[model samples]
Target: MNWKIGLADNWRRLHTKGTVVLSGGLALVTAFGPAIIDAWNSMPPDLKALLPQGIQRYAALGAFLLILVVRYLAVRRKGGGDGAA
Candidate 1:
């Protein structure tokens, strides 16, 4: 198949799994948002200092993006729709 067809096929096969993962993540954040913020607020200064300045705010977003990038790379390396289902 052409690359475009293969890409579309891969996306169709992967879309449900991606949706579930993203939905679950959103649910967890919604359930824990308050407690998570409280924990972050209560973190000791020394421990908080271990992270780079200004990183605390973006850490979750960065981690989520990193997971996506890694998954995409792994899928590409596996030849996407060419791989066995």
Candidate 2:
């Protein structure tokens, strides 16, 4: 009944679910990659210009990484930082 054990179990459950979701998402992106690229290419130049040249892709990557870090921290904090599970 230790809290750390409870947190470990919770984290394991969340990790399994996250893995499944990530796998499905990656498959979907792969399936749509070509079409997505075509649509982006067909987008209007002005619309694309909303983001500064050469930085949009990096910005998106940074945002995704930030989200991942936030999720990690939240889970770690809930688990009391004992490196459980």
Candidate 3:
């Protein structure tokens, strides 16, 4: 059964302590997962040599910036007042 709590009241209950803890936990998981994945992904010998160190670092930085941009767009879309006239 789906028992989603309503946020219409008690915003503080969600925002004060619970949200901070939840966010911190999720941030840890998100960060740690990528590190593990990157370690495995960098293991192959031929593929690593093909990309070269400098290009791979630049590409990784660009991918991170793109992720941030996508997240900003998603937040804006959710909170853009639905483009109401």
- Across residues 1-85, which tens digit of lDDT does each residue of candidate 2 receive? 6554345456656644544465466567668879987988999999988967777477557656755765565333455666765
TM-scores, all models, native as reference: 0.47, 0.45, 0.30
lDDT winner: 1
C-alpha displacement of 5 in model 3, angstroms? 24
- Candidate 1, residue 44: Cα displacement in angstroms equals 1.1
* Model 2 weakest lDDT span, ten residues long: 70-79
For model 2, which pairs clash?
A: none
Q: What are the per-residue Cα lDDT tens digits for candidate 1 across 1-85?
A: 6554345445656655644466577678769989988998999999998988888558668767865765565333345575744
Cα lDDT tens digits, model 3, 1-85, are: 9899766575665454434454565567568877867885878888778766687468557656655564454222454675923
Off by over 4 Å in 3: 1-30, 33-38, 71-85
Q: Where is model 1 more than 4 Å wrong at Cα?
A: 1-16, 63-84
lDDT of 2 at 76: 32
> Which structure among the candidates has the greatest TM-score?
1
> Scored by CA lDDT, what does every candidate get?
0.68, 0.65, 0.60
Question: Which should have the higher lDDT, number 2 or number 3?
Answer: 2
In model 2, which regions exceed 4 Å deviation?
Answer: 1-16, 59-85
| lDDT for predicted candidate 2 compared with the true structure | 0.65
Worst 10 residues of 1 by lDDT: 70-79
